[model samples]
Target: MSSISNRIEQISSSKPGAKDYINYLHSLSAAADLISYAKAIIQIPDGAIVARPVLAEFVSYTKGLADAREEVLIATLDVLKEKTIIFEEQEFLAREALAEVYEQKNEFTKAARVLQGMRLDSGQQHITDDQKVAVYVRIVRMLLEDEDDAGAETYLNKCALLIHKCNDPAQKVHFKLSQARIFDTRRKFLDATRKYYEMSLEEAVDADDRLQCLLAASKTAILSPAGPLRQRVLTALYKDERSVQLPTFKVLEQLYENRILDQEDVKQFAEMLEPHQLALMGDGVTVLHRAVLEHNLLAISRVFSCISFPRVAALLGMELTQAEDTIANMIIQGRLSGRIDQVSGFVYFDSEKSNLNVRQKALVRLDEVAERIAATSRDVRIY
Candidate 1:
């Protein structure tokens, strides 16, 4: 306690123009008591403005001494955080540098926790929106790396509120990538596929990075529930020339071509999937099971006009009751282009009707868009 008091008195009583106090800490560096001095200086009364230079000089002075660098930062932050009026700029710099140290050590949660403790998110904290988004993006990135989705999501939502206002295009890309990750983790494959594919097309992104995004799009498209919504993203990915480079390309190719997936094909694709992807769904079936069955059902309609329920069950490797129920559900959802015949033990295909239904849906969407535009125009005129 006396050493701390003497350190504060020295800084307070030193000549105003001379930064001898910084030199004083440097003198103690050889003695390895620099941190004790840094801690004491931060406690100076109304010394918020003086805090940044002391921390900055200490950071510079401790260069090459890795252990001392961390100690100096920790000492400065510990004392500064307790002060009612914090020195914001130095605090930001110290936390960021500390987070970098933890990140390099593969301590992702610690890195995120260090940044999450910053005051930048508060209304009173004076910082640009881009700056705020940058820190939030870093926090989200580390949280995701730690596989803490719930925590990542909490910070990601904060980023969303300010991301659009940000001028940094690079930050925007990072934000979008984080969003794709969150969506993928949550099993919202269709949305993830769209975001990934969209980012892959960006000219600003590096070629390797773009390809990685494209690969993610391909993988998620295969993982998505087979339906019109999934089909749209799949079609986009299949048409993208870069998707051919992905290991999942064969699966995407067969799925898009409506070719019946054989056991070998399914096995190859399953080998590439993550453990969560192979986990059982609520229906006592794996995600792969549902995707394969739904897709093969569509493929059957492409090959034969009609098929017996028993043969359908044999082709899909399912029982008669499950085959009937799956076909019925597909028909009800307007996914499969066929109707089931329980009495005749057959299913009938209607390719033309399915095309008509899709066209009708397109027109319905166009009508809704037009209505919204017209309503907007009316509101503008009233205003």
Candidate 2:
């Protein structure tokens, strides 16, 4: 091993030809000689400008070797980083490699710190915007993986500013996806849903990504506050012919249409969700199911001026008491403009009277205007 190490040292100092370096690496691999290979890597003179590429290649080759020790690789990277002024690009590459090594070892914080340090250090130089965006995207991903949404969000904004610098559509999509995920993790569902829906419409988004965007938008839309906006989003998703076959899409459509969702429908739809999806919107499905039932009840109220509690229960497929409580809550919440007669057990839909009141108010205003016009005419006389 010492003789092999001596020969590697001599070759590295002499800055041998590329073929010679290749032969040396091949012999090292053939013998599974990790120590000598590491020595050969470290012995490549730092100031050998002509041989820097070969040195980097050797370092990368050692990193890929199964027998290479973590400590040795990290130490080699540190050595390379120390010579950044001499080989700036290679130093950057070395930092990236070191961070990856830390990541492979499950030292995520350490990995992120390394990358963050690289970003700060490179800020002093003429780093390309694409490179900066790349680093920011990576840090954001790492921070998100570490469950630091706030930290991820900070970097995510920085990435957004530099996103235009990225010419690669896929990379831009990746950053946008990451930003959407940050919004999701932070519970900004509406914003996330909007972004996901937008991504679904992007022509650059591949079929798989488009499908995923639609699914995510559907899930987030369910959690969004009930309003015309949510309804509009659901309508768009339902009209998306590509998603017509998805089970979640079917569920969303049924809920939006105020159709009663039975247990079997929910069960089958639940099967299509990933574990994380189930966790994120498990309660959302329940709420949506309840909303559907209530919406159906509202429709019933609109159609029938007065309906017996039992009839309401029958229409909603619920027990009489559950129906009563649901309607009572709706009335309390002002969602249903109606009154429930507890003694008679009837729900009187006052929507018609509510409309009539508006008409009556309009007539009263018209009569007052006519009276005012007559009085003004009488006072004006022949003028």
Candidate 3:
């Protein structure tokens, strides 16, 4: 205990050329054992202020020298494993050093403790609110990426509290919007929608913030289940003074595609929309139709590939019977001219007209007509 206590005091005092001493210790065969000893200093009883400072000193010394990786690792382990009194002692700089080394080693829990230490030290003169917010957001995002939602949510709530302290109302709203978006990503759709709705209402009262809020609320509505909630959000969007430039078109087309609204509803929505909105709808429809054609064409094309027909159809979520019928119909229409391989049951598209019989030729002609219709529909911008 005396030797360990002396080493801790030497670390705390950081004598001249102290880095050399740490290197010398690292070179010792007993360096790992010394690290364990430093860890025990941190674990010493609560009223042991002298011991805590010594442990902190040792940590500081190790932090200043890269050769102290073993010591730093052991200190970090004490925080997680030994329930050492890091939080109460204000040994943040020591914890920060430990976190840096652990983070370099891809040890997230130790890195997270750096944030916790900062949180404990947050009211100190040096740690500003902005710095605290930055740390909270970083740690929360890391936890989120690791799928530790509970931990992330705790930090996010802390971030939200700090954001609420911002003097600018707009900045506060921005933070709230960000909070809502994070919740949305976690599939807490109702919470997201509620926050978005409140923001939209509040911002709509201010003409300058209205458009920004409309865009946010529109996105929230799109994610929500089709019901009064979505309708309410849409209604709020439409009521905004800048609603003319808002995203009504894409939302309507998306709703139509999802079968949440019918053709008559689409027509009504188009009529209610501005010219730019109508143009946007036309663009969405064109893209949708092209996607559908590509999906079908790609499915048919794959039948000629080495892949099994049923396997391709199953992947496309089409019934094997429907796939067969569709292929046969395409052959008859002359859009596709191919004989089904007897062994593989795969259709091979033929380029030569002479290769097609009378029924096949007629079918190919019909397919040409259908392709023309599809192309015309895709090219026309009715909006």
Candidate 4:
């Protein structure tokens, strides 16, 4: 640390006068060890002031130093921006710090306006490449926060261009990830999936940032459109993996119910689901479809736990009367082995059975009625 500090001092000393010294300090202050740089910055006095105008500049430059250390940077900037420390140079530095500090504080539009106004002034031409990148990133974040996705995309593209020009690999990766997110938000599915997939692979191979890489890969594969191409992509993704995280049972059921996946796939998907997810699948199906399946006595009891009779009837393309008669006949014929709720009209199935003469006879008659309806339907061809 001392060697680096001495080297910075040597470089700055070669350039005569205050402006060069301030520029040197600004550059050094953006180093990884911001606290040491900050302490070094505070040691430089400008004219009669206890600290130099560059001190605020340094603090504002490193405002995003790790979360815990950010407070010191923020506090330092606040002190420099105070009204009592007034000089043309000092005021300019203070305004620059104000824009940066406000951006870190997420006062985005205010920061943008400050930066925009500053750009109109000749003083803004002195800003560095790093400063422009930081400012534009804040603008992108602000636009995303406001749900102005197009604006966010424009700003992020600008940041990407700047970072690319600087040849900063780390920031390039970050900018690409941000671009992927923007595409995701815009529902540019193929673009998002491809970019995220590439980013994840690069991050993984470089072993630079594992968690972010894995997250990118997960999101990429999770939302990718399914077909032959998607299957090939998944095959590559899982080739060396020990296990894969499948989509939720609800999602699978929806795909199947909508004919996105076939019945065999739906059954296989259901078998893979956790019990709770399986239970939720009933509600995931169309109301009329679920009701029809339940009325035919084909639906599972676990599925019925999540659905009501009216919803089931709606699924089956039947009226409440039809549903009630179907369930009643099941009970009467000793097939349901359940009790009927008189109030809500819900049928509660149990393992119990009833032996009766009158109900059995009535159920036989009910079956005849159902067969008659089936025959009548078969006879008609409205189409």
* Residue lDDT tens for model 1, 1-383: 57756866866775442276666766665323766666676666536566558767766666556665676667767766765245666677778888887898899999999998888755545799999999999999999887788899999999999998999999999999999998887778888888998899988799999999998888788888776677788888888887888988888889998888877978988888766668887879887888899889888887889999999999989988888888888888777767777789999988645644566679988999999999998888542
Candidate 2 lDDT over residue span 18-76, tens digit each:
65665776566532364455445545654355446655676576665653545655665
- Clash totals for all candidate models: 0, 0, 5, 7
Whose lDDT is greatest here? 1
Residue 297 of model 1: what lDDT? 85
The regions of model 4 sitting more than 4 angstroms off are: 1-96, 99-131, 203-209, 240-383
Better of 3 and 4 by lDDT: 3
Ten-residue region with minimum lDDT total, candidate 2: 276-285
Top-TM-score structure, candidate number: 1
Measured against the true structure, the TM-scores of the candidates, in listed sequence, are: 0.83, 0.67, 0.37, 0.40
By TM-score: ranked, best first: 1, 2, 4, 3
Candidate 4 accuracy as lDDT? 0.51
Task: Return whichever of 1 and 2 wins on lDDT.
Answer: 1
Q: Could you tell me the TM-score of candidate 2?
A: 0.67
| lDDT by residue for model 4 (1-383), tens | 57545654675556445555456555553334454554444444333243454555554555445453345544544444433334234434545555666666777666655544334224523556666676666566666555567877877877876785654555566677767767766655456656766776774246445434444443444344433233344454454242133333333233223223334544554454223222333335432233234323423332454345686577655677766766666666544455578687676765313322456658878999999999999999987
Winner on TM-score between 2 and 3 is 2
Model 3 clashing-pair count: 5
